[model samples]
Target: AKQIDDLTLAIIICLSRLFLHISADSKYYQSFFWIAMSLLQIHDTKLFASCVHFLDQIVHSMSDNGCFRGQGLATFCASARKGPSERMLAKLDQLSGLSFKYDFSFAVAGHLLKGLKNVGTKAAVTRLLNTFVEYSQENNPANVTGYFAAILPHCGDNLSESCRQRLLSCSETGSSVFNAGMVPDKIRASLLFTYLVTILKSSESEHEQLYIYKALEEGAHFMPDCLPVTFDVLMKKMEQILVASQNDQMLTAVLAIMNCVYTYGLESSSPVATLNKQYMESIGFASLGSADQFNQNQKGALIQAVCRVLDGFLQL
Candidate 1:
């Protein structure tokens, strides 16, 4: 029975990857996201090793533009229940070098974020993020925004103070070119949102919180739904943003309120619950079929907003 279960799991991962490979549309790619999610659940080291080997094979065959897909695969691997072996880490290192040739830095950033639980691997990931941040700033490249955006989620006490200082500095000057005609609105929005989200999620120093509150107020003028769902802890944060005396800060506070309502104000369900269901199904989990409970229009609108933001980042 155990052998049979293992076989079934292997088959599912392979089939889901194949489906993902064939699907060009985001929706279809999302449909097979479950394969990666399922891979994350496996505990058997040997079986996990085999899965990473197969994904590495896929990475080798990718075109230069297609390399980002491999980075995405690496992110999935990092999200697995266990850490990688020395051999796998070496492979990740090799892939990281190749990832710079394409716009795969965001995918690499995702993997780095997931791998941060380990002291050694986390150091490697931090170095990689630092390199990307520096490269982006020095070269003033376009798509590096996506890569920097990915790193934002993992920024906190775990990151060095130097790294945090660099990120904060980027938030100020990074958007300058974006505000100029050089960058598109979508890319600008994505970069701004990424910086905002990172600031919000990071350590709650009063100075840092004040900076984020000011930035969010400025950002709310453009993308209104940028705030994450506000529960108890987040509600207090929102309140602090609201209490600021500046009119721009108040505008951001209002936007945060609106986002909380739109995100968590479901009559019978929560947005987080709905998003989780959608995410699980995309990764190929057995369907609970409860996602249909939300108004289709509402779900579509929320998804559209997110996609628009992502697309904007990609444009950068």
Candidate 2:
């Protein structure tokens, strides 16, 4: 059985690589993209590794030939050994239309994200990301926050400084690629929250902190729809503050998050309502409520915020 399984995997990998090699021409990019879409769905780790290898190869090849040319993408593809042939651009521009399919856009997003780990692929990664961003702007899909969350891995420290700056500019307020709303799916929501928590825990910049809080506010508005994952992440950070050091900024952020939860969760009728009530009781008894740790005025402010959120919940 194991031998048969291994043989099947070998054939799949070989066929995939061969297909990519044959379809490597710019005119065949739509076929190339479908092959990539299929590869990303493979479940076997070993087979998937080979899939990434060929996908990476084709991306670099297309990049070297300048198939990724455009206004915002020129800088990334400038290293093209030979500028793209006009014929190739015309053909591939047709292929770029595939980004209209949500699956196609996200498959490209997944590949570009994984490819970012290899420094050699930086230029290719940028070209692909730029293409994805351009397509997203023109289409402006509903649930766009989910798409932004899909590509959020680029926001991490691993990205090159230049690439990161470009991404920030693309996603900044009013950019067509940037969207504000509740993230659409649990997986995307989790990714969004993880990034938010990471920024909250590490970023000392007030502007950055406020940006994350705004996202938290949106997620909170959906209540138990985002449920335990979202609230769990926030509560853990709140607990960290309660048990460890005192950070007024973090405390204010947490309180603001709590207010969002109560304000939005009032009619939710999800278990989060019960869980939140329990949490409020716990916070009243936690060290966060202690006078020794927080001076009278500080404690009063904390209590006041909690009371206000609680009062609104009661009114509902």
TM-score of 1: 0.35
Per-prediction TM-score, please?
Answer: 0.35, 0.42
Residue-wise C-alpha lDDT for candidate 1, range 215-236, written one tens digit per residue: 5444544444433322223445
Error of 2 at 204 (Å): 20
lDDT of candidates 1 onward, in order: 0.39, 0.41
Compute the lDDT of residue 263 as modeled in candidate 2: 67
Instruction: List ranges where model 1 is wrong by over 4 Å.
Output: 1-103, 116-122, 133-140, 150-214, 225-236, 239-316
lDDT at position 200, candidate 2: 57
Error of model 2, residue 282, in angstroms: 37
Candidate 1: how large is its RMSD?
14.7
Model 1, residue 184: distance off in Å is 3.4
